[model samples]
Target: MLTKELIANIYKKVPKQNVLSKIEERYVYAFDASDLHEKVQIPDAVVFVESVEQVQEIVKLANKFKTPIICRGAGTNTVGACVSVHGGIVLNFSKMNKILEINPVNMTARVQPGVVVGDLQKQVEKIGLYYPPDPSNLKVSTIGGSVAQNSAGARGFKYGTTRDYVIDMLVVMADGSVIRTGANTIKNAAGYNLGSLFIGSEGTLGIVVEVTVKLITKPEASEVLLAYFDSVEEAVNSVNQIIKHQICPTTIDLMDNNAIKTIEEYKNCGLLCDKQAALIIEVDGFKTVIEAQMKLICDILNKNNAQNIKYAKQKEEADEIWDARHSSMAACAQLRPNVTTDDVIVPRENLSILIKGIQKICSKYDLIMCMVGHVGDGSVHPQIPIDMNDKDEYTRYKLAKSEIYDLTARLGGIISGEHGIGLVKKPFLPKVIDNGAIDYMRQIKKIFDPNNILNPYKIF
Candidate 1:
């Protein structure tokens, strides 16, 4: 769909070293965090865009040539959002990485797209402020990718997801016009909350160039607890019981025995954990406040007949305790070279049932499936490990995926949480979204980018 002459022409309109060809340079743009997508083919060209104006020129030229254009950040999306399926131009935003401004007094920071989430956290904490959205891939994921997908994290159980922290953003539209969606102020009765709307649009609406996010005062004290259970039901119910007690922990995460065994086998880290289910819980506040909550947590776990409840006192101990939970993606990756991870959000009370349903499906398929979740908010990722070389593997994989989504919807759950409806979930979207809403969303996409040039074939 593209040729060297057309790419050369586009590069001629920008700075030197901005354009790439199909042979070797274009190979990097072929894939993303998604381990199983149909396939990835190298794009005809790749462009390293550094500025909003440059993006504008590239988009205009892409529009002129009627070629597909993909906007990519750290390429961390668990879907094919950045894949150049039609072989057009791939635009990488790494060069535009810049921390523009930080306002500690107001607890807000303005940053360009390519800032790493962990780097942003480090920068804010140094100034006595905190950016609390810490995704599992924070060290490698970029803010642009996080905001684009409305990324959530372990902190989401307390601080809420990235959407809650984002105040405003600078987005570049299809025709290269730059528009600001939100304000830095605390509250506004503005026109539709466009900023919130675009937060999880998954690059289908526009490309986020700059972001303004709110920060919070870091908690002075924290406590980590690990509660083990012989049954998933008990472990999941414990989370609800803890919530009913009105003790909101900063994070309450779950790891089934399969997940633990997989991680322990992969790292030989001596988890010393063999229970059927475990909850790695964290509560943060002032020293006295968190201490009281910690006691209440212990009581609840004991009441649930938890097999074991372990506590970590020091900061280092807490870090070590949570390391296994944090390395879930890596642990699962070691299980198979290819993995298809799905996110489903159910009511907090139904977490156990949802997990049970997933286990049933995994067993029925005779698959070696592992599970882990953000138990606080009821977001679980059941990774479907695959050997992509085998064609029949995906056929069963698709069936399992179909049953999972349908079952999640039947249980009053959502198809996706934290992750957006990128290409991977496009087909299932119709199953979850109301027809009226889907039609309106399609209309909105048409209104914004009539030519479907912003990011074609993403959410839809």
Candidate 2:
């Protein structure tokens, strides 16, 4: 819907180097990390926004033309949150990446939406602070994408997700008006908490231009423990036992046999491919108490018939252990031409049943699924590798995906935990959410963007 006149208007709002309208350049913004071939669409124009004013101008222009304005950050989100499914305008935030303020005294950092998550962590950690919302690929993922998806990583069990850290945000509504969701301070007992409405809205509600994130003091000591189990039940039982002991580790992540094998073959991280499941547990606290915690955790694992357990002795060793888990998606990509990852979560008590159900469903469809998850929070990500070029395989993959969501709903779990319901999961969202709730969501979208110009048709 972006006409030549409207494209010229957008170029007038930014520098000459900021706007991209060439066919080749627009093609690059068509897709994201999501492998859903059916949902991909190239935008008519890709505009690189350098400031809040430019974003507002673009939004106003979009509203005027009734064109969709899809905001894009690093575009690393696995749920196609940044894809332009409709022919409109794509707002690239790469030029707006800047850490505006780091208030050490207040323990909050005000940053542009385009700032890299890992880079922000490094900068904050330099001042003896921590921002714990990690989305696996934080090295390249941007703060805007994480905020939009409400992303959490392995550490989510202890530290919570991006929604917990984001105290305030500068959002641009569809009408080109600006609004601050909350104040810069941490504990706001203020009215409504309007920020929550847009945090995980997946760019469907408004465009996030700036965010103020709360930070915590860095822990004195932390270590990762890799434990192997002969059966998935054993690994799950170990998790329950550890929780029963009242020990709160930073993470309780699990990987199934297929995930282990893929990582071993791709990265050769010395992972035991023969193990049915593996748990990566991390404990952090005072240096003196870490040893006691590790000792107790070891006892629990051993009691639950853990085949073998290894703790990282050095920082490099800890990185090596985490590398295996972080490399899961990349490793699965090596199995076939295209790989799709899903997020499903249930209550902790049903974690084992969920895993087994997913395995059975994938096997029934003859799909290769590498499963990994943050078991502490009962979330699972099953990465399935398939050749999209093969029509038969693609059909089977679609069927398997639907069945997996059905199993998740049966186990009292939603289709997504960390990954928001972008285009990939929109079709199945109604299965979990009630019709009344969906109606309210639709009403909210109408109230926010009456013209349906801001990332239109997402999350429904």
Scored by TM-score, the top model is 2
Residues 1-460, candidate 1: write the lDDT tens digits: 6766677778777776777774777787888887545766677877888888888788887777777788788898887878866678888888988899999888999998889999999999888788998888888888998988889888898899899889989988887788999898867788899888788887878888899999998888788988789899888888989999999998998888788888788777666556898889999889999888999989989999886577987788788778877666677778677866778999887788899999999878767677888989999989767777766776777888889998888888888888777778888988788889999999999888888877688888
**What TM-score goes with each of the models?**
0.96, 0.98
TM-score between candidate 2 and the true structure:
0.98
Q: lDDT tens digits, residues 1-460, model 2?
A: 5788898888789888888888898897888888768857889988899889999998999999899889998887777777887789999998888999999999999999999999999999999999999888889989998889898998999999999999999999999999999998889998998898898899999999999999999999899899999999999999999988999999999999999999999998799999999999999989878899999999999999997798899999999989989899889889899988889999999999999999998999999999999999999999999999999999999999999899888888899899888888889998899899999999999999999988877889
State the C-alpha lDDT per candidate: 0.84, 0.91
**Candidate topping lDDT:** 2
Candidate 2 has an lDDT of: 0.91
Where does candidate 2 stray beyond 4 Å? none
